[model samples]
Target: MFKDRLRATRISKKYTAQQVADYLDTGLRNYQKYESGDARPTFEGLVSLADLLNVPTDFLLERDEYLDALGVSVDVSLECPPRRPKPRKSH
Candidate 1:
């Protein structure tokens, strides 16, 4: 599933396998292993690949279904507020 998506996206973006390998700073054989499903990328590498492919990491991992199930919306401008600690109650 992951390999198919990676290959399809790479081709759709008109990127040669060697180009991707170079971008990822990995050898051609090592990158080929990723396509062959004989190896998996590290979390950092996954993020880098997703960035280069202009996709979310979940899409590369075939985990986007989980996000769809939750119906979560991605908004770059949304910022999370800091949480305040609760005051201690008197004994």
Candidate 2:
């Protein structure tokens, strides 16, 4: 569950696995294993990942679905303020 969420969140933010691995200060292989669901990170790693992913550790643990829904609302914004056009030049 954490693996899936991590991969999805990373991809959504246009980050490669290597980038995340670098952020975690772990080998790319280890990061790949996490994403493959073959292993889990240590407590520190989990917290670090949650911080990097901008999600709570509980979300990575899939402890609450409500959090996931709430995260979707906050992590990816739906709208941006409109930009006003520059004033036209006078003749």
Candidate 3:
């Protein structure tokens, strides 16, 4: 599920696998394996990829059934408001 969505999102964004690999600071082979579902990315790696692609993590995860119910298309490249960090409590 993630593999298919990753490939589709990359293609939709007009990004080559090599380009994505470079962005993620990973080898071409490793990135290819990711797209092929032979390997999965770590949580940090997924966050990095999502940042590089300007997408929400959920978009790459392809778990947008709720969005679909609301008639929203799951296109990750769309520009969204910057995420605000949670407030930290003072000691």
Candidate 4:
């Protein structure tokens, strides 16, 4: 899914593979591996691709469905549940 989105976005944005590789500071072969599903970019590379393509990182990661399926809004703020102390053992 990620590979498909990446390729589609690149094509839609009129970016060549070589162009994307240059922007990513990687060799064309390595970039091709990303589209071929043989490799994945690091976290920073993923963010860089999103920024260069003017898309959200979540979009590239295909996380929109998770939000939609869970009825979660982008503005929803979730806090971690508080941890409670364990009960002491009886003497």
Candidate 5:
């Protein structure tokens, strides 16, 4: 499910395997392995891919069932907290 969803989203977004590899700074062969399900992405890599695909990380992990089990609604519109400004150094 993870492999299929990842491939579908990538294709839907019109990204080639090489494009995804370049975007993630991963090797083409390694990225291909991910799509083939011969390899799984690390936690950080999964997050990066999800961000690039504009999908939830859980979606990539095929964890929607877990979300359903918890009765947690998925809302992608939740805004991230704004970055706090760096403190100015006193001269």
Candidate 6:
């Protein structure tokens, strides 16, 4: 799935493997391993790929069960919780 996601995003954005390699400052063969799922990128490389692909890092790396484990849920509302008033001083 990681391979598929990487290849799909790269194709959709009209970038070749060599172009991605250049952007990453890596050898083409090394970068190809990432798209083949034979190797995974280092943490820094993951961030760079996410930035270059214009996708959230999670979009490239996350699985559904991982989301559940993280207890993350999306909220569309922009409202902030109300702040509490200051307590009165005793005489």
- Please state every model's RMSD to the true fold in angstroms: 17.7, 13.6, 14.6, 16.4, 15.1, 19.8
Candidate 4 lDDT over 2-68, as tens digits, reads 8777887787777898999999999998998897788999999999998888777787787988757
* lDDT value, candidate 3, whole model: 0.79
Q: Which residue pairs collide, candidate 1?
A: none
Alpha-carbon lDDT, every model: 0.75, 0.76, 0.79, 0.79, 0.78, 0.74
Residue-level lDDT of model 5, residues 1-91, one tens digit each, is 6777778778767778899999889999899888777898988899999999887787777788887887765544322234345569999
Summing lDDT over every window of 10 consecutive residues in candidate 3, give the lowest-scoring window: 75-84
Compute each candidate's TM-score over C-alphas: 0.72, 0.69, 0.72, 0.72, 0.69, 0.67
Q: What lDDT does model 5 reach?
A: 0.78
lDDT, residue 29, candidate 6? 90
Expressed as tens digits, the lDDT of each residue in 31-88 for candidate 3 is 9888778899999999988887777787788768866786766545533334345469
Q: Given candidate 2, what's the lDDT at residue 9? A: 68
TM-score of candidate 5 against the unseen true structure: 0.69
The parts of candidate 1 lying over 4 Å away from their true place are: 70-91
Worst lDDT 10-window in candidate 1:
74-83
- Give candidate 2 regions above 4 Å deviation: 66-91
In order of listing, the candidates' clash counts read: 0, 0, 0, 0, 0, 0
Query: Which is better, 4 or 5, measured by TM-score?
Result: 4
Query: Candidate 3: TM-score?
Result: 0.72
* 3 against 6, candidate with superior lDDT: 3
